[model samples]
Target: MYGAITAVKDLALTVRQGEFLTILGPSGSGKTTALMLLAGFISPSEGDILIGGRSVAAVPSYRRDQGIVFQSYALFPHLTVRRNLEFPLEMRGIKASERANRVDRILKRVHLKDFGGRMPSQLSGGQQQRVALARALIADPPVLLLDEPLGALDRNLREQMQGEIKSLHKEFGITTVCVTHDQEEALTLSDRIVVMRGGVIEQVDTPEALYDRPATLFAANFLGEANLLEETGSDVQAERSRPFGMVAIIRPERLRISTRGAPRSPDADQRQSVIGMVTDTVYAGAQRKYHVQAGTRMLTVREHVASGQQVYSPGDQVRLEWLRSDVRFVTP
Candidate 1:
């Protein structure tokens, strides 16, 4: 067990070598604890952790042979970029010639080849972050662990660095485990995402599966915005009564809105359409979000608010309809 809190249940996840697995959860969800435990910073109280098929629960931090990066960058302010990249090599007693060559190569790879002489304060936030990543990769550890590495940068820089990190992972082919709270970041970078809640595993699958078929109510709500609706009492069955709870989860994008009196198709099922009055419309780039009030329920619909499209305002009566396939049954 890596930094996972023992009093709270910890999930045992097996990450294959050279795969990019992301531990994703909200704050205090044990994602960071799991990363810490895997990095050998903290010991598991009960169970053991295995790396490369060997039990590594007794391994000390310095002997774990894993490189770690944190949100704060943790770059040494007093050291020049070259020195910062060289520090880990120096600690390992790598030859000066090899150290210089590796630093030069990584500096170029991270696009900081010309800034080797600059101090941390002299570089931009993004540049300083790249230096930190370069330093982490300089040692070439077998496994790489990251705890919200791009959380500090602005939106644009964060997106740019996410690409850089993905590219770097491909170039190195090292097994990586990242901890992040950002859904899009996890979706974009991870080969598989392990979603956690209350220090236990909620679901572990590719980003697409976790998003489209969340196993639990918490997993459904945590991954993205979801509209949860209770099924009518008549729809309940004996076998699914306790586990399924007659609830359905629908993503915002799965709904479509039609004005009152619009003709319904012959195949349109009444169960999939809800009568609602437009309560709000938010103009988001690429798509607009419409909040519709259907009786006591509020349904959100995402539609492209393109030129020549019919725009509905507040108080307009509309029907929010979706396909039955879009409705995912969540575990109660």
Candidate 2:
């Protein structure tokens, strides 16, 4: 709590051993604060943090058996990569021989054995990132914490590093908690995700479950493109599966768009159809997105770009349909 402005309030979470958990949220959502609290950068006004069923709320950051990788890489500019990797071990009082061995093994593990003699300034962004990760793991800490570790890389590099992080996690089987605002990063890396809003946990579930079955409108909209069907409610009022006091939302990918005169599917009776005019069309590399104006709501539809598939223009009329079961109801 900073000057009475509670950054995170009543937060409760448990990360299982060897599980990769991600705390995802936008700016001011308190994800960083939560990570800081767990890292012992700041003490929580209330509630205790437990590691392996043992309370460590009062433990200092350095005393806790945890490794951390920051977004900046945070390598010492003057130190060689090998020296940076060895720093953590030296701090922990590991002998010189053991430190050198551990550094060599870790550098090889990150595929940077030969680059160790170079200073941090000599390495590229990706190389520096690997060095940081290796430095964090050189001491073999029980837990790993990542604070937007890939934020400094470009799109392609970020994607590449995501695979690297996943492979390392699988190999090490360390319980890791990462904080990031990137939806794709969270979706791709997390075994389970905790979505926070306004300092409170909005939802917690597996990546697939969180995206497919969000419990609130904020989560549904935050994770991906959720088309809120304001007028769609009337079309599917007879849907017995829809709960009371909920609004309907469907993913842009779940919705299909066809020409206005196109024939209905064989299971038309089991779907909801709406007529709308295309407001815009986007040609993504592998997929196409269409913005359609239906009733009072503007809906976005995404489909793979396939051969022989008709492309709609801005003025073209289109019909959108989706399976009744695809319509998820979430709290407003």
Candidate 3:
């Protein structure tokens, strides 16, 4: 329990065979600690870790038969790419000829066949990341652990690496557990996401379910932008009643903005509308975000940028509407 503080208490998680699961949380949420415990880098005080139905809580990190990639890439600065990839095989007492063949095949698989003679310092950031991943998988470990694997890359490189990681995971069919605070990364790469808070699991579900129907207010806001309807000081209209101590929430993209008193959707009977003055408008490349002040609450609305679409500016009165069925009740 780390003296007086408990980091990741009563944690029980199961990762299916060949499934990609991500542990997502912000700082101080115990995601890293949980990963460490799984990796055998640290022992849990109260629970055992099972891999393939066998307890490994007392196993050392190196003997756990798992591959790990850290945020720093962890490639030896003085070693050539080929040597770095061969290190894992050598540690397993493999013959020199076989290690060379495995190294060549893996380097070619990662599209770095010609860069084997180069040192870590000579390669670009993306190239170094590839080397790290290749080294981890060269041993054919059944499970893989990634600790903020893309945190060191820039935006464009990170996106590229995400695609690469996804492709490799599909090809290898290895069970993987990733720890990251990046919401977009979790949503893009995970088959299921485990949301953590205060050293406990907040929710666990598929990415779509977690985003579409978060059970808690913390999860709703963490996954994406949420509009709290009750704070508008107006009655909220929904298809179902909200439970006690719960609030109604709608995603920003669910709200449609139009000119005041404009034509409504075909199913007008099932929709609700609200009028508000535009407080701010943001133009992202592919979409636009609008902040509107309706009564006492500021609501956000997002829309894709399309041709012939009406635009709203600050101080402009706009009508925001959404289907009553789109509203979801969540715990605060």
Error in Å for residue 11 of model 3: 0.6
lDDT at position 216, candidate 1 = 84
Ranking by lDDT: 3, 2, 1
Model 1: per-residue Cα lDDT over 1-332, one tens digit each = 33443523756788988999999998878888888888988877878898878889999989887788989989999999999999999999999999999999999999989999999999998998899888888898989999899999999999999999999999999899999999989999999999987788889999999999888888888888888655321232222233535467788988878887899857585336777889898998899989888766777888876898888899998877777667777876
Instruction: Give the winner by TM-score: 2 or 3.
Output: 3
| Per-model lDDT | 0.84, 0.92, 0.94
Please give the lDDT score at residue 231 for candidate 1.
Answer: 35
TM-score of 2: 0.97
Best by lDDT: 3
- lDDT score of model 1? 0.84
- lDDT for predicted candidate 3 compared with the true structure: 0.94
Give candidate 1 regions above 4 Å deviation: 1-8, 231-246, 265-271
Instruction: For residues 246-271, write the lDDT of model 2, one tens digit per residue.
Output: 98889999998999999999989888
